[model samples]
Target: MAKNKHSGKIVQNSRLLVGLVLLVLSIPYSAEARQKPNILWINCDDLGKELSSYGNQQVHTPVIDRLAREGQVFTNAYANAPVCSSSRSSQILGLYPTRLPILNHRNMSPVALPDSVPTIMQLFREAGYFCSNGAAGDLAKPGKEDYNFVAEDLFDGTDWRQRQEGQPFFAQVQIHEPHRTFVHDELHPIDPAEISLPALYPDHPLIRADWARYLESVQRADRWVGEILDRLEEDGELESTIVILYGDHGRPHLRDKQWLYEGGLAVPLIIRYPNSLNAGKVDHRLISLVDISASTLGLAGLPIPIDWDGKDIIGGAKNSYIYGFRQRCGDAVDDIRSISDGEYKLIWNRMPEQPYMQLSSYKKLQYPAYTLYRDLDQKGELSAPFSAFMATTKPDYELYHLKVDPYEIENLADNPAYQGELLRLKEQLERQLQAVETYPQEESEALIQQAKSSSRKYYQEAMQRRNLGPDPTDAEILDYWNHELLLNQKPKTKK
Candidate 1:
């Protein structure tokens, strides 16, 4: 072996050649493995699970249906808080809103995030990801970051396309549809008679008309989603991005928005992984909006913060139950908390003295069901189910098994047979409350007076706008709304 130097040199050259070939082969694989996913969170305000994808044919949401068909569907996702500000605050940080004291709709003076807590956007930006919050509107405007926190200039820009070349981006695009002031979508009109009105409200013509308008708004929102997805596809970002489409909360209606009922807490969640990975997979686990943040981090190949309240649900691990709470939305000071394990749900109305249909300014002006409930009670026509829920006072605790009672009208808190389930959820709530900031038990007199005064003034003004008398009957109210819906017909004369 020591005799031939040329032969030794030839064998050494051959070994080096093989090493170079292997190194070259591994570079592209390593780069591909290290490549992070761009995240696009498509949020539609006040949208419910009414799309055709969710089995509501009245809602014509082709774009969202396609997303459902091509992605993983979460059948039982909920907003941790019903209102926008609280839910957004909870999800953005992967923590409960009470811990941050962002439970209110909008604090007159918002508190900035503490030094210790970092937002998901903050984490992504630290990882060199470009973060953008923009409106998915016709105009390229800054997105509605209606977070009850100080969020001015927290984002890099309003456009994900403005990111540095080859940089991954996290974009939150707000589509304000089906929120309020819903009118008939002329382009996509839904027949009022076709709407499936919930049993919680009076089945009046005005209510049906309003529900139809709500679906029309959803149809409009669906078009917005289609536009966003098309733009991504045109830009060659669709296949590389993890697109998440969801409602911030439930539909803005009588029992839905700002309440702890399933209508308010439940939201439809659809996630399309890059290249349609795991398409058509449906997850029936109970999940909260907060889990989305941690899951997003996980999908992006980032380390989730250990202090975060949410877990990485993308790994198939799920929470047994999701929680929801409400406090001081629209000047109403009733504190409510709810827990649901997908089938069973519980509500704790800490201040039951405040009625469910309290003097909330926006509801009086926007919701027709509010008027029907008040008018029916005055005539002593309010019956069992309606009277129980719309009474002057509410029960301290209400429980329902949603699998059997989808409407949640029947209260089983006192039912002897359901004592075990009630106790379980009650104990769970106590544990949850202990971990967060203590809730305020007493209502502020000043806030109550202010809210009532504002509500009465707005209500009277709204009535006047509809050409209604000081004490108009339900028929009169229906007459005006019917006229509004029928633009081709002559307007109804004021009484």
Candidate 2:
């Protein structure tokens, strides 16, 4: 296990002129793979490092834990963007969304990938390897393709079994478990009291119970992982295939998923290579999620695109910095950029005047905890740090020393003692920002209001179904979601 020590230092890199891949590898670059391994990408939705392998004992993910034991577990991996569509769109082409200028989530209009960059699926099919993207466990079912850009004919079929005999397969299996509206696992129940609430959340049973339910979704996803591996074993391909399991971004929580915080941008990455290569090793290399694409092309013995943003992570130099972005997620409109160099992180909130929860209809509908947070803050039950989240306005810049302040509750940006460090990273990140073409940040307010109006329809319907009184408190909202949705019981009769 590689240790990440806080040097309280910054290394200025002048070569951030391309993709959001400044965190380049320091190890010698090598792409020697004579035997092309069948790649299996198990991409789960809105999942973070909740598995036992990552040291969260509450969620019993034996299969994923076993994979961690038999594979290389990455400790420092961040998504290029917080939202799924933006991350998915840039990842396949081995570039960043801002560099490709496809930062919109659920974009009504999408541009095709640059003619220079060919998707890995197209290349794999051209190389005679079968490509499939389907649900986890049952590959016959069509999987989620929430790409922000226009991608066509990306898959050969829904399942690898349809491929010609002896043909290698590159399967992109998307697991939907653990996203939202978590399914309770009856067989392995977790105690609500056993959960640990983050500082951003109030220490309440409702919050813990909500967390336990999310763990149930994690358990369900884990069981399906076992089923996927079992099928590979039964088909006599387990030993020959290279399985790469990762989350699209982070957990589906109140402040996660759509934000640029660590809870939203961070994800779990595990690579199980055939013949037990690099098995049982825990690598703490600073890496971005897009590196998987470049690594994929290298693993397939194909020539990587010259303009591909990500580099081969298998054997690369130490990362200087990794960048992330948040822009136009769902009905919410915001522009936030982040740059981290393993120890220190800097977040630039372009629209700092706006409140954190500014008409994000998805959060209002899907997360009962969202209501609870606002209610608690309104009641003055929430203290410093966490209460700051509910503030009407945010600081233009936020900085955290991740090694010392892993939870990111402290704001070192305004502290006079850290002025030198703050300005250094700020100027450094600004230069990095200039390199990428993030045009969507300049989108009009009219376009945003139109999209918000469209998404509000679904939120209104869900709220109507619950039928909480117009002035219902957060307690009533939480209780409604808990009993009505999770327990499969109707909401309490509104009197």
Top candidate when judged by lDDT against the true structure? 1
Q: Model 2 lDDT vs. the true structure?
A: 0.78
lDDT of 1 by residue, 178-275 (tens): 78888568887788787788777777677788888889989999999999999999999999999998899988988889999989988999999887
* Pairs clashing within candidate 1: 134-143, 135-143
Off by over 4 Å in 2: 1-35, 467-476, 482-488, 493-495
Instruction: Let me know the TM-score candidate 1 reaches against the reference structure.
Output: 0.87
lDDT of 2 by residue, 280-384 (tens): 999999888878887877776665655556777875645678888888877888888888888888999999988887767788777877887787777889777
Name the top TM-score candidate. 2
Worst 10 residues of 1 by lDDT: 1-10
Error of 2 at 98 (Å): 0.6
Computed on alpha carbons, the lDDT of every model, listed in order, comes to 0.79, 0.78
* C-alpha TM-score for every candidate: 0.87, 0.89
